[model samples]
Target: MAEAVARTSYGRLVARLARRWGDLSRAEDALSDAFERALRSWPGSGLPDQPEAWLLKTAHRRLIDGARQSGVQARAEPEIERLLDELTERDDPDALPDERLGLMLACAHPDLDPTLHTPLMLQAVLGLDAARIGAAFLISPAAMGQRLSRGKARLRERGARFDLPGKDELAARITPVLDAIYAAYGTGWDEIGASESRVRGLVGEALYLSRLLTELAPEIADVWGLYALIAHCEARTPARRDAEGRFIPLSEQDPQLWDAALISQAENALRRSLKLAPPARYALEASIQSVHAERRVTAETNWLAAAALYDAMIRHAPSLGALTARACAHGEAFGAERALDSLEKLQGQASEYQPYWAALAHWSARAGRREDAARAYDRAIVLSADPAVRVYLVKSRGALLR
Candidate 1:
């Protein structure tokens, strides 16, 4: 119950508290305290009728106590007074205004390091932990924790506003906001059924943010592009596994299981993005997804088109994921031998990325490099967090032995 509340209401609670208290770190600390209190008290008192309201009221009190105890009451008098004013209005936590977007933008403020923006938004807006955000960025949890602490302190020191920025400022901070949303979605998408990855629930939150962005910034092409890309991916979730819960790669999945409505929505968003601007990073990615969406009607994926979009994506972003995906797409479009050559160039950078090893194993097997395929498959399986994916890799490896 607490976990579910944390997954759903944590961001809303934090956003409200941060705006009222004018301190992101304190907001988070107070909320953490509220959750701890709930854990200790809920078991004995039975579940509260309104968990979010309960948590909010408790956290509000915590903020007041902390401010008074730390000699911050005078410095934070106005915020504290506002908190007290809000204390009487805590009957319906759901009625509290959602300031998550404002909070996210604040985290993306230019004063903060650009690289830290995504991690900060992931933590502040989606309630993701440093460990989970670190996993997404390939940083150590301890190091990520330190970085996040510094980021919060920096935000406070710089006095980043908790309100929405002006149009020009919004544009400046919007890129990292989009990146953070995509990163959050990717983290959740990858962790599907992995028990240790509790943040898998964040996928819905990411989608919610994307939808909100499309409404808030209708003129921004990248926002629609991201929405389209995410919707396209979500549309295929039903087909990603077989009846027995075995993993199914995109090429082999039954397109009949794909959500046509979502594909249509994605296509419409992609069209909007293209009309607004040339295909940039997210736009290029959405185009790739659009090509895959075509497979539902054409009954075949256009690897050449996907490969071309990936090449274009590299020109824009050149992210390891894009590069690795491009290699796999080229392998499908050209030949396994050619694909293996493309992938070999990225071995140094691909060592820790599971998709790279999986693609390498597939192309190696296609190229009839039995030993190399076996080794790559072993590594891919070892790195895979999804049990179904590991099972698929094991089966693929067993086929080599036969």
Candidate 2:
């Protein structure tokens, strides 16, 4: 229970401190000291009535002590005292604003390098370590660490405040913010755990953050669309693995295990997004997922409809993942041969991409090109980092050889 609370509340605590101190690194250091104190005191004194508030109060004192030790100017002492007074006066921990949203906006600031936005957000908001984020971004751990350090340094040097953007500036920052949320969700989605609980925790954090964003910006169509998209995918969580803990492909997943409530929520969110103006990429993707979700009642996939939606999505988004999904949809709607032809056009471009090889293997197998299928599967298995996915690919290749 302590671990769970720590996972969920750490970001909020850090965000609150970062806002108050106006120094992300210093805030983190103070919090780290507070946690160490908790580790030692909690085991002896028993758990505090309110762990979060206890941590906050401890962190507040640590910050002040550090300031004094560093010989902070007398001019700032009164301000620090005021902050301390406020902390002491607050009885309800729940009253604290979820400053994590503001921190996310700060991480995705337009002034920062665009490429660093998602990685920095993942680290600062979700507490993902550099190695995990490095895997997501396909960078070396050393490089990822250096990049994160540099991004934080830049924010400090620029005196970037941990605050949400004003109405006038909010629109421009929306894309990066949304992208960072999805990137976090994707990391959770692909994670392979000994049990589903670990994966669920990360995915749940991402969903929580997305929901928070929607509440903050309810009028944004893409925000609703993103919420719907994640909800739709999350609805299928139970069916993604079997009783024996092996991975199950979407097509083979038992519909009965899907979460009906989540699907309903997804549908409602998608409807709300559709009511708004200008269709966005996320909305289009949600629409596609909606069609898949329909199989729960209809007992069949509408491949033709999905193919059309993918075509539209490609026109609007044009991502490699979208293109790969489109090819799979085409294979279902049209035929494996045509899908192979389309995938061939992307050969050199997507050669190193795991999904590309996996798709090629599937299509080749369907087209009766046994040798090509085996080769493609071999490549996919070699490139896949997720143990479950790698195992699945190996089993698939073995079946092909048999």
Candidate 3:
């Protein structure tokens, strides 16, 4: 029962209640109260045969009671009332389960402030904590307490329709929605270091949105590109961190730990993306990931091939970040000398980060250019304070001495 409800969309649940009760505010309050009651009552009752229905009934009662007490007439839309009655009659919670997730997407629409939209989605759709949301946004935990309510009210004021958008309309909004999913994955992938639980939460959320979007818009290449990129990237999740909970670079990671299932799916998606009229960043990144993933050994990696991919990547999406990735790819494909040449092109790109210098230092030391490696390492040491990176520099300097 818990699993069923867990799989079901809380977004749909809230939207249904609001639509039926004719008051979003009242619907949310009643739902919260019902959930609280469920927690208190479930353990003693040994769980319900139909927990979702039970919760819905409890929320319904709360809504009716609150409406009567407040002297508010039942002013629900005629269509909404009809839908509510139909929902009331349906014995199966699974009948329209996917609607819940759709509600989540609608609530997180671009019309809302990005900062507030994510929090509201986390709360109403994902059931995330205020503290977590606050940390994700780098704010006071208390600030998130009413953010969902406020965001929802703003949505209500704008008459945000709960119904899913038409195909073209949905495709128009795909960019932000897809960005949200990618942001979630990065969140999860970076979590132990930043917002750990949230990182996982966002990964699941991304996949959920991907599945939802692809199902609705099967012909959309961007959506397929997103799913492919994520699928490719997630294959390395297990190898990303070690059993000791330390970061492992892709080159040094234990390839044995990668999830083959994700790789297989990624390959299929990559093919699908390639067949589309034009390739985008997602498709390009997925191809790059595939190159690394298909390698038999670190030495066997097609760095030159990867460099070419990154070169194309920068053209598709030019940024400092892209420059950095391309620089690393050059280091892999060409000799340290050529890679250093490539990186030198970005002398002032990120004067603060020094990824180029540090990488150049490692490459120089490995290529037996002690003096050059030491100089590059010194530059990196001055610019960056990351302990692991410092260790890498120190180790490079040591290797030069050896």
Candidate 4:
């Protein structure tokens, strides 16, 4: 129960506190202190009827105490007192306006280094520690920690506000926000049903943020596209694994188990996005997923259509992940030899990329290069972070040996 509440509420709680205090670091520290107090006190006192309220009051007091101790309260005492009074007047514990979306936008503020936007969002808005964000980005935790600290300092020095941008300024800031949300979703999607609850929480949080973005910026085509992409992927979650908890590749998933409502909602959003603008990366990606979703009704996967979408995606984004996915799609639509050629060109560039190894393993097996397939699978299993993915790779390699 504590774990679930922490997972669901921690980000929002921190974001609200940060907004009120105008100090992200202090907000985090106060909330951490409050949670620790709860852990120590809740066992004997029994759980409070309003845990979030209790947390907020405790964290607010901690912030007030800290400010007084630092002697900074002299100038800000009136504002601080007002905020405390506002908190006390709230009837519903969870009724705080979701400030996380605002915090996310602030983290992706254009004033900061562009490269740090997604990392900062992952840390500040999603509650991922620097170490976890570093692992995702293939950076050392120390480097990520320094980067986050520097980013926060820059925001503070510039007096960044935790408010959504105006319409005139929003477009310039949209890309980083979209990227951060996509990164969050990808992290969760990789670990679904893999016995990692924290990672799984990212799925819901990403979806929540995406939905909020769509509502906040209804006219933005990519917002709808991103939501559609996430929805399409999520629609297949019900059939992603079997009773034994083994991974089920998309092709082998039971279509009957797919959620019809989510698929309908995804298609609606995809259509709306396509109607609004020329293709963007998110729309293109959603189009590819839309094609995959069609397999349930058509009784056949459209490899050629998917390959075409991948080609478009690569031309637009040119990411290593996109290239690797395109190689697999090309293999499905063309032949193993052609896919192998594409994968070979990426050998040096994508050496550290897990999907590259996984793609190589699959294409190599299809091309009847058993030894090469085994070697690639070994590399892939070693690099994969998700235990389920590692197990699946191991099983694939065993099949080749047999």
Query: Whole-model lDDT, candidate 3?
Result: 0.67
Clashing pairs in 4: none
- RMSD per candidate (Å) reads 4.8, 3.8, 4.1, 4.6
What would the per-residue lDDT of candidate 2 be over residues 155-207, giving only the tens digit for each residue?
99999989776765776668788887786676434222222443453576568
Q: Highest TM-score among the candidates is held by which one?
A: 2
For residues 285-382, could you state the per-residue lDDT of candidate 4 as single tens digits? Answer: 99998998888999888999999999999888998788888888899999999899999999989777887898899899999999999999999888
lDDT of each: 0.83, 0.81, 0.67, 0.81
Pairs with backbone N, CA or C atoms under 3 Å apart (clashes), candidate 2: none
Superposed by TM-score, candidate 4 places the C-alpha of residue 384 at a distance from the truth, in angstroms, of 5.1
TM-score, one value per model = 0.76, 0.84, 0.80, 0.76
* Runs off by more than 4 Å, candidate 2: 1-5, 42-54, 111-115, 128-147, 187-201, 368-374, 386-402
List ranges where model 4 is wrong by over 4 Å.
1-13, 33-61, 83-97, 110-123, 126-151, 187-201, 364-402
Q: After superposition, how far is residue 56 of candidate 3 from its true place, in Å?
A: 3.3
Query: What's the lDDT for residue 269 in model 2?
Result: 89
RMSD of 4: 4.6
